[model samples]
Target: MGTAILSGIISSQGSGSGTQEIDLLPTRFIACVRRPESEDAIRSKLPREAPDSTVSVYVKDNCAAAREADVILLACQPHLYKPLLLESGICTALKGKPIISVLAGVTSNEITHQLCQTAKTESKGVYDTDAFSVIRAMPNIASAVQASSTVLEIHPRPQLKGVIATAHAIFSCVGTVFTTKPGNFAACTTLNGSTPAFFAMVIDGLVDGAVALGLSHTEATQMAAATMRGTADLIMSGKSTLDLRYEVACPGGATIQGLQVLEEARTRAVWMRAMAAATSGQSSLKEGLKMSRGGF
Candidate 1:
């Protein structure tokens, strides 16, 4: 997800017509990984405005990255959060900084709790200062192509307005950005991440069916993908799903016959079940906390 956002930001900084879009290009980007060998992978994603911007990749040195960054992104695996803050000086360096975390199922409060655990203050039970200004986001791999459907958790943080706008600008470069109440975050996360993969699966099946019906695989794939994009555009433009479906399903039409086949098999219900299963195990905060104790 982090890599996709980097690629998207890089791609968004330029236009096909050769004009540079400077506003989308940040002055620097820092990416941290677990190994020095991983540095090249990040280097491969350098921004289009490289000379105008600098990218520094770190190996197992997130503390250094945190110290230098005005905005911090926590892209580590969910379970690694505990250890991430365990790095000496990390929690202190991050105090009151704007943080954007893409870890699924981890909340801003959970992250703040972890940081407080590490940076126990000399004063009574508090940090003697404000907690990290954190933003929770759920974005997908499609961000690489600038078509990601990203969600940002919205909570009352009157002082974090500037940070919120920064978060929005960064994400909007990757795709459409939607802000929803934090209470709806988990449901939105379920819809944000896996839907793209599910959409791809639908396109894949259509391509195979097209192949079986005599179209070349490559050509069928292109047509199916284009149709999917067009359909999404129509829906986004306020066309109701039922209206679009019925509009294309004329009386005695092939489209309606195909729709009947899907209806008989309960395809829509199956899709709903798949989505439900995605987060079914994450039914409680206890479960999420347990999972948080286990990743990278």
Candidate 2:
């Protein structure tokens, strides 16, 4: 996720200053990993051969790294978070730090309670200081290329203004960012996060249709992709999708003829039904607050 965000930032901002600009920035990053091999793999992908930024990559356990960090990011699998934070000494280290958990289905309230319990057991103060913040974010695969549409829900904190700004700046480098309520976070996931898969399926269908009509697989795919790209550009050029469809359906033209067949088959309805099924399943999981250890 971090690498994805970095790539987005680099793509949008153009690689120039190396790490000088990052170091001069107010925010500092410390990545905590469980294994040395993981750290080495992460290091091998740095923007520059050896960038000079305050972003330290620690190969120690979570507990050790959580001690000195002000804002801790939890990127482990959802199922592992509860047990890891409880069993690892890391919970004790996060005495008054803000936590940004990326685990889906795990609520901010749950995270707050778990950390608070750990703090109490360790004789530390309650995890309710002005600096003690928690936020939940949903970022899709595009984050790797810095072209993701990231959604964030931050728990209210007095000292979080700067942090929020920093987060926005960082995420904006990758793509777009939207602030939303935690309750709606899952909806955003279904809309923007899952839409890529939906689009891919649509493209696949189009390509298959072209191949069935005697076009080579590669040629069909390229043509379908370019057509979709052009269509998207047209829609983005200030026209409603429906309006654009009508514009393309020139009076009694081939486009209109094909559209009529699609309409007769209730193609639009079929698409809607598919989306409804996906949205319903997502809504059920979110309403139940069930945490699963799986990728989105």
Top-scoring candidate (lDDT): 1
Candidate 2's residue-wise lDDT over 130-187, tens digit each?
A: 4246677767767766657778886466566555655565566556788987777766
lDDT of 1 by residue, 119-230 (tens): 7742236663257788888888788888888999887868667667777888887888899898888778778886777898999999999999999999999999999999
Error of 1 at 88 (Å): 1.0
**Candidate 1 TM-score over all chains jointly:** 0.88
Clashes of 1: 1
Task: Go through the candidates in order and give each one's C-alpha lDDT.
Answer: 0.77, 0.65
**Per-prediction TM-score, please?**
0.88, 0.75
After superposition, candidate 1 runs with Cα above 4 Å error = 16-25, 45-53, 121-125, 281-296
Of candidate 2, the 10-residue stretch with the lowest lDDT total is: 17-26
